[model samples]
Target: MARISYTTVSPLTHSLNVTKRWTTSLGIWGVGAGAAALLFLSVTPLVRREVLVKVPVLKLYYEDTTPASDKPF
Candidate 1:
């Protein structure tokens, strides 16, 4: 004949283990979310300024009777 023994954890220990697991998971998620927010904020200014820059222009001078051949092509 064989006898088996089972040990049970206390209620306080079980509650502590559950709380530890929840806090650890929450901390990991919070760090990831914070990093994503910082990256977004850092990149936003560069993207927003792209549309506000002006293009360069050149000025030309010519006579009313200037022929097409005399103009800069």
Candidate 2:
């Protein structure tokens, strides 16, 4: 009697494993970058008007209270 051993590895899983072993700080950097992007976008009128203003908790914090005369844009 003979038995065969089959093994399979996903390309994504392999690359992720390599990345995990290569550096532990990679994920921390990625999170920081994402937060930076979110912070930058949060001040934009498009994001404020279309997204942030809809959140009850954040709406007050993001709202623009300056008079039109004082606006630089």
Candidate 3:
């Protein structure tokens, strides 16, 4: 009697085939867009408190430095 064997496609290979070079480029572009959005939102109050304030390096940079006399809003 002879043994029988079967070959199967791997998950990694399947995924690689489903995604093309353009998909990888699009992912890189998406990351860049997200970073740009975060940078633009950095000065907003919500972002400052929730994101910048927690960062050790940016914490000092985002601190309120103005005096009461200069603050009107």
- Residue-wise lDDT of candidate 3 within 1-73, one digit each (tens)? 9999988999998888878756998999999998899899988989988888898988899877889899897
Every model: Cα RMSD to truth: 16.9, 7.3, 6.9
Deviation from native of the Cα of residue 54 in model 3, angstroms: 1.0
Predictions in order: lDDT? 0.61, 0.87, 0.89
Cα lDDT tens digits for candidate 1, 6-49: 89999999999999989989999999997777557644645324
Best first by TM-score, ranked = 3, 2, 1
TM-score of 3: 0.54
Q: How do the residues 1-73 of candidate 2 rate in per-residue lDDT, one tens digit apiece? A: 8999988999999999998886778878998998788688997889888888898998899888999999888
TM-score of model 1 vs. true structure: 0.41
Best by TM-score: 3
Q: On TM-score, who's better, 2 or 3? A: 3
Compare the candidates by lDDT and give the number of the best one: 3
lDDT of 2 at 73: 83
> Which parts of model 3 have CA positions greater than 4 angstroms off?
1-12, 16-27
TM-scores for all predictions: 0.41, 0.44, 0.54
Judge candidate 1 against the unseen true structure and give its global Cα lDDT, from 0 to 1: 0.61
Displacement of residue 45 (Cα, Å) in model 1 is 7.0
Q: After superposition, how far is residue 29 of candidate 2 from its true place, in Å?
A: 14
